[model samples]
Target: MKETYGFKTVPITLRESYSASKNGWSALLLDDKNCKEPYRSKKYDIEIVDRVGGGDSFASGLIYGLLEKQNTKDVLEFAVAASCLKHSIPGDFNLVSIDEVEKLVKSGGSGRVER
Candidate 1:
């Protein structure tokens, strides 16, 4: 843990895992202050359009979630969801609103435009 090395211990640790078997992405977040069992997010099956700003988007979402004072589960889910949506956008920027990311996080991400 970076906290052990005199670093900021905000989220503690976040690990992103890619599952070739499921063809999707899942994330694990560990923060003792948040939950007893490590918080895990449901897999996000997204189409990769552009990976340029995926990481930055995740960090942006994480900051927003923290600012919103969300729980550990919701924060991690929002960050991961935001990053996944970035991959589906074809540019260097993640042009998604909070509602878009929240919709994906809450609705299990169908990856389709609603009618």
Candidate 2:
């Protein structure tokens, strides 16, 4: 994976699996510190139009947070929250605001009402 992605070394917490009959796989990235967050928030409250670009949305959010010099915790929260919000819509792109992601982060990814 590292060689393909042009990395010097593989991730220390690396994992990989394949299924001959399966078509594809899903990836869920979590920070050990953020384990308290839910695996998946309420779906009835969300309307997912597309789920294709969620991964890219997450990466972009993480990168943006990191570039802003946000703390590791904030970065992870923003990234995951952005990814989650992306699921509420269709397509590969999630049109979300950084503030929205941060709001979800502040609420612990519950998608609760913001004060």
Candidate 3:
């Protein structure tokens, strides 16, 4: 598609797996020129509190990251982390702020409460 349509990049989200206590999520970012291999996020193990709106949260995070002019890798990580955090909240909407998502990304989803 990049060759035929002159596309530069494409982003894809994957629901890697799910178990009784945890759900896994990943993201793949393909950029034709800069990235030789697809940029991938580390598998995030999210404790599931609600299943609804996870995908929406990911999409929203991606869009928000892009709008905020974050780097490609940071954007992907932020999106996955945001979606992972969404699973821990008991609602259809993702209520996490960018700071919270950034904290998750930095802390590697440790599930520790901020004091």
RMSD of each: 3.7, 8.4, 2.7
**Model 3 off-target regions past 4 Å?**
1-7, 18-21, 32-36, 109-115
Best by lDDT: 3
lDDT (Cα, tens digit) per residue for candidate 3, span 67-100: 6744677777887888888888888998877788
Per-residue C-alpha lDDT of model 2 across residues 37-73, encoded as one tens digit per residue:
3233221133344557866776787677657733455
TM for every model, in the order presented, reads 0.76, 0.55, 0.79
lDDT of each: 0.68, 0.51, 0.76
Ranking by lDDT: 3, 1, 2
Indicate which candidate wins on TM-score.
3
Which digits, one per residue and each the tens of the lDDT, describe model 1 over residues 1-115? 5447652324432434354222365566665657656677766666567777977888887788767855888888888888877877788898888888888887865644221
For every model shown, the clashing-pair count is 0, 6, 0
Least well predicted 10-residue stretch by lDDT in candidate 1:
13-22
